[model samples]
Target: MRYGTRALLSKALLSLLLMAACGAQAHFQELIPSTDILTAETGNTLALSLKFTHPMEQGPVMSMAAPRRFGVMGPRGQEDLIDRLRPGGTDGKRTFQATYRAELPGDYIFFVEPAPYWEPAEGVMIVHYTKVIVDAFGAEQGWDQEIGLPVEIIPLVRPYGLWTGNLFRGIVKQDGKPVPFAAVEVEWRNDGSVTPPSDPYITQVVKTDANGVFSYAMPRSGWWGFAALLEGDTPLKSPDGDSVPVEAGALMWVQVRDMR
Candidate 1:
């Protein structure tokens, strides 16, 4: 009886550890544009979608509230786009969409600052500062422009028009200063074609150097998301009115094309 009880206790502890590891796996705030590189022939406008999810898992999407802030930084400068956001969804989960007319020949960086989300499993409030770049009319200038987000990834490589297998690098910044030795998570948007052989394959992790820069090479052609996570200095109130830590994430999305 003693041995049996010990075995049962061990199993319970292992199960709890597995559950925690799965919960810790990476939740991404996705802000993806309809197209990364927009040609003149494509159209005069762009459609952007926003969601919070585990991208590599293809999701059980976490419902997103209306963003706290939304805007675009382009050749002319930043413009408020909060009013343009429309309600959208998939699989019964609430999401957001925005349509913007591209009147300039330059790179447009679309950004979203989501409202704080309480994750019961993690016992923290999550706020992801998400952005994506769309190059318009063959004008590649301004892809690196900073939107002055609280936490952001300023791309060392142009965020759009990339081929698979190319190295992508970005600097993780908080309040315009590099966040040394930051942790960044990378995941590919699963299109239902690939499956992870193990749990670790779902979200790839990398750490920034002392200068707050990290790099990864894209192995497959698809939309890739990079999230640099930092703990906020201030705690927020949970749904239960308890004070909880805030997980502030800097997220960026970029699309890669196949050689074919």
Candidate 2:
């Protein structure tokens, strides 16, 4: 084999790997509810959609496996609702859906611990601890409670009942401690009405302040997701039996409505 040929092949592999890493960074694990606020008109049975995808891009979705845990922290207590999840997807991409019946008129914080996803391109195992909140019967208690995820975003502001342009704040935590200077990626779940003029418009980036808190003022009225990723304390073994890095993300979802 010629040395020049080997060098060209190596450069090609590096380029391919960089492209894959950028693509994977755009992917987000989404856990959005049918409605952020539940009322009698909407009924007590709430439906939830769980998908791993680029919220802004919308179509380049990745398949998601059954989560390690899925449940809610209601006003009464934490309830394990994993059994309610059913297999689902779009265009053959795997996903999950579940229905939860709210018996109380209080805030229900729904959360999911996704199975670690292997990204050969990025060469890292990704796990997103995602959550969303639904206020039932106008009782807003328990929206601020943390579910103790490996990485979590504790909302500093009320996650629901917001109009477009309202500023949202949260603290990024890993292993129950503040992660100062954490990088957070924010995206608006596109409804096909908006087109990204360029790649940079698809996702927004923000960094936490000295106190591990980050703020973003949502300009559009729709579902918005924020993901703060950090390296896991321990590495995980890859399918090839080699040690690889683990990326843990603390994610939360919120909805904003146009002031009409």
Candidate 3:
């Protein structure tokens, strides 16, 4: 009998341990814009609304901050940023929502982590992240143009973390028609730092294609300011042999000149 009792007690303790483990795996659900594709003007403020299957416990501390600890990597390998979702005051009917906004034009990713009290037993916590592309022209015009230029900077595969490239493409309208350029000159700066390559692990330069489209690439990653030169006094030679300025948001020049 003594042996049997001991065995039973051991089983009970094991079951309790398993139950506790299950309880610790709470997760999030019902995230709005689950795949949030925010196409907002540069200066416009937007909110990211999130809902969950389970209500978050009141008074639990939450946090929202950019993820920077992870090292810079290509688009596929980059880590997502974590933003804490705070209860935006309860609705009369008990529904809850949280919101966030993009203040600049570029790519941004966001994720969420719930506090311990909000977790559920045997459930997996969900972390959601998405890339948002903000249009710079929207900032000045307050509206997105149908034929506006879009720029993207991509990194090339290189060793020693130093090889990168950039690509620029836009529609230039002349006589009410589309004139596509294969290349253009691009100039960019980091957040108040005049250091070479700005963010250390990146590269920014003017690039052109046989069709007059422009592009640039960086070896590193960080917040960067950039502009395109349609036509200007060329200070430096470009890889495609075009004279252009390294400026930010200069695509308008090309449109204006073509219109003349």
Candidate 4:
């Protein structure tokens, strides 16, 4: 081949490569539940849809999960509920959807990953969480702090029958009294030692109820450490009405046994 022709071909190939890279980056255009608030009822399915810039390639494995490193903080700056993403609908188009039931009411967050063709086409995607308010009718009552009631998770024994794992719950309190509308987080550590809880195992967060209670269930059968945190913009008021700062990383430990 001529020298000039060879040089032109190399440049053209490089340009094509760059264009392909850019296209892949744009695949994830936006998340459907983009708003900071999501309203749903207890036992009702919450659908989270992801809109891509282009139609996703067929056979690409897409999955979603809650944030492994962080937990949801309630309005009082305390961890409230257990949050998780259950697999939902998969339409071979510019969008993908995941459905999760709103077990309780309060704020929550989820981390989603869309990987097409087994390659790291996209990095970690975070979907800002919103409040899921459940009413007596089992329907979303919209966002209203006046009638807002915190939701709690109650463990129903391991579904598998024989598994040793940790159980976690979120607690919201105000003036030494539990906050019913506060969010709670309970994380399970895979390692038996509980000096501090780390990552990998399933974590759940839930909001407290009018009575102030939230719970989380772990899948694995073993010893684990747990942490509870309550977070919110509103400063917690003391008995004297003094505002207090809310922070993360409040932790504790619990022993889970396999009775099955």
Which predicted model would earn the best lDDT?
Answer: 2
Alpha-carbon runs more than 4 Å astray in model 2? 1-25
Best-to-worst ranking by lDDT? 2, 1, 4, 3
CA lDDT of each candidate? 0.87, 0.88, 0.28, 0.35
Residues 1-260 of candidate 2 have per-residue lDDT tens digits of 89999767754554454345444547688999999988989889888999998889887788987899999999879999999999987879999999988998999999999988888878778888999999999988899999998899999999999999999999999989999987788999999989999877887889999999999999999999998877776768888988777778899999999999
Worst window of 10 by summed lDDT in candidate 1? 14-23
TM per prediction:
0.91, 0.90, 0.24, 0.26
lDDT of 3 at 177: 35
**Predicted structure 2, TM vs. truth:** 0.90
RMSD of each: 7.4, 6.2, 25.2, 22.4
Ranking 2 against 4 by lDDT, winner: 2
Give candidate 3 misplaced runs (Cα > 4 Å): 1-44, 47-132, 135-145, 148-183, 192-194, 197-204, 231-260
Residue lDDT tens for model 3, 91-150? 422223444445454333322322212122312122212112222222322122322212
Model 1: pairs clashing at backbone N, Cα or C within 3 Å: none
Misplaced by over 4 Å in model 4 are 1-171, 192-202, 231-245, 248-250
Alpha-carbon shift of residue 227 in model 2 (angstroms): 0.2
Write the number of the candidate with greater TM-score, choosing between 1 and 4. 1
Give the per-residue Cα lDDT of candidate 2 at 186.
Answer: 90
Residue-level lDDT of model 4, residues 53-129, one tens digit each, is 32122223234333232222333333422343333445543334455443455433332223212122322111222
Give a tens-digit lDDT track for model 1, residues 98-184: 899999899999999999988887777889999999999998999998889889999999888799999999999998999998778
